[model samples]
Target: MGRDRANIRVDLWADGDWRGLSMGAQHLYQQILTHPTLNYAGVADWRPGRLAALTKDRTAADVQRDACELTEAHFIHADDTTEEVLVRSFARHDGVIRHPRLHVTMANDFAGIASTDIKEFFAFEIQKLNQEQPELALWNHPKVQTILKAKARDMKEVTQRVRQEEAMTFGSATAKPMAKDPNSVSMRTATATATSSKEDIPSSEISDEIPRPDVDELLDLLDSCLLANGTRKPSRNKKNREAARLLLDRDGYKVEQVAWMIRWATADEFWRANILSMSKLREKFDQLKAKAGVATKTPSAGFHGEIDVEAVLGRDVWTPGTPPEGLDVAGEIAWKKEQRNIHNAERLAEAKQKLGIS
Candidate 1:
């Protein structure tokens, strides 16, 4: 319920549920999972008007439809009569709960709900857990055991209907139970997160060869490059992280390619002025590549009237009508000398060829 821990873990299970959901539904589901108060309890008052106040894009009807989809997918449970919604798997954890007290407190809160459907659903989940996870301490809790026994008949009847509904909706009675080891589930989930390797990434039938950048290293490199090129370092935020993730993880840009582009853009007088951030860098990446292609190829001999000192020095070493920055002066002089030497050597070779020297 605290804003200090607003972020929530979005496991890879979402991929399966996403298939039948509309974009609006997925967004609403995320809102439910991540909303500060709702995230902690995983239960919310399902008043349509109340929910509509929180979701501007969705009407009350849309909210109802989305909630139904989530229920059909077994992502959540909603009782229209009581207006209480519950995320079915919210209390389920693959591993030992990090904070048992907090998790226990939250579970207790849900257990106290005054709705029959909600109580039955929670009791059924507890029974399922007891069967699948006999080692878990929840099964040993006297109160939890009592609740399961007390609701035994209702839980059995409700669970059977829920399974039937699931089969009718999804062609399956229930999602495959997760393995006991949280690590196994985490390993599978890893494939879906930004850090996934080539093998983990799903293909269309099913996913790229470009090595994903180490996110930390990539961000550090961005800052270093910006600082070296005299740009102020910007604070890292969600938008910046997203941009970098898209370019490196999703867009298949190599880390080196990103570094090269960042270097090139920040040194190009015109581009340096425009591409001052990672978002801008991602936006102009193709243009930077095209420009780099032109620069690296170098004009064929005698094909140019004006020398592009920028191309020679890999930076804007000469600005029109003014002396270049002192930082570039040394590089400019060295580049010009190298160019003259190459030009002279070429002429000498041509002369020797004319004179029939082997």
Candidate 2:
């Protein structure tokens, strides 16, 4: 040989045969043979002829050196009852060729190693071998490189498709319109308009249009009527009496009419006394006229004393210490005319009683 190192080729022997084998196969064979009951007699018998044939192509010295190299390589044991052969090619640290061998024996002659198990075992061993001797370029073969690349591309395509589908679904959901009934907008607008109109209406306008009776006038009439009958005490305030008298004189509502409007019974003593003055209308008029120095010029019973001038005007025509004016004179004239009727009625009643009228 030109160079002994270059010419060196490792020979793997199974039992005694020079077989081409893998590191995984060698480890598996060793594991099988380690079982005490495993039979290797048939394999050992077949090995010598195979070894002889392998060496026929090589010089004796080279073959012997290769066999020695193979023997020195590490061996891993597999379980007994495994019957298969595995082989691989590797290089030594010094660049010498080493072929590993596998010889599987059945510890109990039941079954052989499964193809999937063999393949998985081989793959694991190859990975280990690559780790141990990274410079070994077995995984760099074209077929293995092509298969790995194809698997990577297929995985990438599958991932991209899944992401694209997910994104499309999400976009469609977000873009979908919210459900709205056709009439909802119109209803909302109508409600809002009604609410705004109600808010804009003023309370004062509503109050002014609503009709009700004047409570003050009704109450004053009740007080005056009750006092005139002696059914209630006379009002202590002169102003209240004057005010009530003025209101009644100006309106001249009939007793029954006043009672009906004020929801009082005409038969009630207080109602009859206040409006008709059954007690003292005549006497009171005379007293007031005397105090005011008003003269009763008529000898006829139609006229009596000075009238309540302010009472006829429907409000006070003169204040205390205030001199009478044109309006007061007019009010006095009207009051006098009303008093004359009352005095004539009284005189007529007296004349009727003298004649024993029923």
Candidate 3:
């Protein structure tokens, strides 16, 4: 049986995650919670089009965008591969562990999940909850272990720790990386590639020489580019490495040229999400180069002298660091001034607090 009701606290409005969301996103979250198809495991059919139809003015694209915002906020998880939406904390919040009989339904619902990514993420959430609330002792339950075992979407079903980790590394071709790896500079790119099934560059294409740190920066640059756009980071393990290698070794693009192209493609509103991997970057390099040339030579004019900076730079979350390639003198000055203003604001707040001002 599906969820008859979900436990939504009245104080939900005061929650940090909830308070930070836009009104549309907040409404979408509520609608999902009360959705008829939401199962015992808190997974609901990912039908944004249908959800959109429920409201008078909401469009499918609006729903999709709000869902993306929610996913990025870590309050929920959406996997297009499985076409499923998961309320990440639902298992704990549902109080299922308090009722032993609910285990059967929870198991059945979890087993029904087609996405291994969701399964892994949900299982981690449950284990984490158990750790924080030892009284739950979730794993100690006999059926709990069997229930949380990730059923492979591609290969044989596995519950072994080794197999689970292996599945995580190479399970879904299009799966987003589960965790950030600290050891690698381009962690997201490496993880995404390691798990991908489509090998654009063959094993034979792999060079005998390890990529230099400078070469690897190409991969890192792609990761940063995506992050700057607030886009989901694709693992860069193979697709990034081989594509970058080919660009340098075979296609004959210099490191600086490739780096500039990386920023160029990623800075475009349309291309940033599309050109995820280094392989994809290589595929679209020429087109990107051509378009970038046009944009640079003639900055798109806005009303009067004002320039639409966003048109030039994709909605990247710019930070205090190396400015993106192709940023004009005016743009650089604006960025620097914004940073200085932020610093001044902080200083003002500190002084006010020290002076016992409200």
Candidate 4:
């Protein structure tokens, strides 16, 4: 039997794949995630008969079909010969780094509950992962190694349990280790900051235009708009801060305006998928503004209702007959027709103003 997991963090943005899943497959995925056997190892028996019992009114065949669906969707991996399944992203989803001891217990528990074939498969898988690229090997994960280290410490201090508790790695608040880039300066903070005294933090990453909380607020907005990869600050600090500086100081955009742009871009179907980072946002700001239907009108350039159609649309708007050089005949005709409409509208507006019409 496996241990209980009280709750699992569900990242709604990352799990957009769930929306397209069949109801049966969705149900099966949920059952597997919450199964008692899905402990620290995140591997469990893929026995259709056993899982079928959990799915109300569903047959073994149905469970099998849904299992296939899950496998195809990269949600779970199952071996036909061994009848064992491993949740691919389980360790990541469960924050395994924070619960190293639990993983050790689950790996140990697997020997008793799992069949011989399943156990053999897991061993083989771990061995292959080790021989090929041990860094990515499931058993050799940092968390697992951390657990082994803690266990060794415990055995050494068997007679001093209180001391063991104090020295334990998994459950201690002060001892909790955060993932960090080895090259980057490590600055563990409960909240985001605009400036850092650390030598590793480049001057470019810091911005004086926006306060620390404001930068954090923009980060929060980006996190909501973007999918986070198991980190508190989702966007790269240097890129994000640089983009913010451009928006706030160079471009002369208000904080509220930048905030609105974040909201609008994230909410837009096209822009949402495109604006993954603040740097990308700053780069495509003009295009996004145009996409948001910001077509500003300009004063008439010529006396004969002639207008700079390009200026009005913020881009080249081919007018009838006089299309920009090298435009094809058909494109010229299209532009001419569109230009006629604009000319007529501009003329009407002029007439109204001359007559003092409201």
> In model 4, which runs have C-alpha deviations exceeding 4 angstroms?
109-358
Give the worst 10-residue stretch by lDDT in candidate 4: 182-191
| TM values, all candidates | 0.39, 0.16, 0.45, 0.32
TM-score of candidate 1 relative to the true fold: 0.39
Error of 2 at 242 (Å): 99
lDDT rank order: 3, 1, 4, 2
- By TM-score, the best candidate is 3
In model 1, the runs with Cα more than 4 Å from the true position are 1-8, 39-41, 94-98, 152-358
Per residue, candidate 1 scores C-alpha lDDT tens digits across 1-358 of 2222433455654666565666766776777766554533456545544565686654443565566455545666655434456666655642312345554545455454645666666667656766776776655555556655846223334434544432343234222221111111111111122222222222331113444346556677878876785556654643355567677766797676676667666666445544545655665566666554433432232112112234333343332232245423234434555664665455444544554544
List CA RMSD, all candidates.
Answer: 25.4, 59.3, 19.3, 21.5
User: By descending TM-score, how would the candidates be arranged?
Assistant: 3, 1, 4, 2
lDDT at 186, model 2: 12
lDDT of 2: 0.29
Query: Which candidate do you rate higher for TM-score, 3 or 4?
Result: 3
- Candidate 4 structure quality by residue, lDDT tens digits, 226-316: 5432113333555466566667766676666677677666655334434556755665666666544334433443212233223233333
Estimate the lDDT of model 1: 0.50
After superposition, which runs of candidate 2 have C-alpha atoms over 4 Å from their true positions?
1-114, 144-358
Model 4 residue pairs with clashes:
319-335, 319-336, 320-335, 320-336
C-alpha local distance difference test of each model: 0.50, 0.29, 0.59, 0.49
